[model samples]
Target: MYYVTKDLFFPPVSQANRDGILAIGGDLSTERLLLAYKSGIFPWFDPGDPILWWSPNPRMVLFLDELIVSKSMRSILNRNVFTVTFNQNFRDVISNCQNVKRNGQTGTWITNDMIEAYCNLNESGIAKSVEVWQNDELVGGLYGIDLGTIFCGESMFSLVSNASKVAFITLVEQLKKENYKLLDCQVYNPHLESLGCREIKRIEFLRILKSE
Candidate 1:
């Protein structure tokens, strides 16, 4: 565990504790966030808590070629019921993700400061968003940092069943076309696993993360 200060620096990822918390207390400036992501680190802290930066040992990632699209998802894609757009209405997307209530969590990690920081990244074209619309009404969306080689997926939300899935699947397809190295999912969860996201050793993740 490392305690960050006013400096814009972070310790090596190898020094992180078992839980992947590398360092704490760094400003969410666009420069720092970009440096963290490029170094295979990301900040995830609850409101009122000090900032926590993480670089998990078994990092969850989606290899572009290994994305799993279920038959049902394929059917939905073919139906064309929802229209998908990229980098459109990003603030709305992140806000929806911020407000969504998860089953195990009482609050959102996407705090107000986080919204402004990432939105700054979006304005600089370093962050990107995917919007899903049904008949011109936004129903689902996702946002993340785009590193050209890798996309660091932060969060997503859906107002209806399969809307977020639609956004995710479409993003995967587009990323594949763009020849992105992989989608960095950060942590493990059933939902991400269902989409063919798997854990890789931190060393391996860093290798790929820097190979670009």
Candidate 2:
């Protein structure tokens, strides 16, 4: 396994292990994070562990044209009961994602250092968040690195049923409007699969990521 240093460099995605861990022990500087996303790698590590960068094979991605909104979700959207906002309360959105309990995990990969680093990334306009509000209260949200052409989703949390889906669908509609090519989910997720996210080879993903 490769080890990261002060220099903002990484092994090629092809060098990643079968489990997708590409490098270890890197700081989450804005420059490094940007480079990692552009290169099909992302940071994900548990607390008290060295920062682990991964570039998984068979990347999970959603083409803007392929988003699948279930009938129930469509009804919820039609009702317009929840308000959605962009870049509003990013810290809260990410913090909630970090704190929310998920199945099969004792802790979150979105550590305090990761949060601070990505918050800085947010201030730089490279990281983005989608907030869902119900009756003026923040209920659910998602956050990620927006590379202009493709969105690399990091994490999402929902306090109420379908609130995260609402935030996700809303973000997809906006990205579709802007003519985005893809939404990179990074790894396999049944929830994302239900929303039409499917896996493609890492090479294909990298080609798309670098495409003009």
Model 2, 62: alpha-carbon shift in Å?
0.3
- What TM-score number comes out for model 1? 0.98
User: Which whole-number lDDT from 0 to 100 does residue 113 have in model 1?
Assistant: 98
Candidate lDDT (C-alpha), each: 0.94, 0.94
Clashing pairs in 1: none
lDDT of 2: 0.94
**Worst lDDT window (10 residues) for model 1?**
1-10
The C-alpha stretches of model 2 lying farther than 4 A from their native spots are none
**Model 1 off-target regions past 4 Å?**
none
Tens-digit lDDT track for model 1 on 73-188? 89999999799999989999999999988789888999999999999999999999999999899999999999998999999999988999999999999998999999999999
Give the per-residue lDDT digits (tens) of candidate 2, residues 1-212.
99899998998889999999999997989999999999999998889988899999989999988999989999999999799999989999999999999989888888899899999999999999999999899999999999999999999999999999999999999999999999999999899999999999999999999999
Task: Output the worst ten-in-a-row residue range by lDDT, candidate 2.
Answer: 102-111
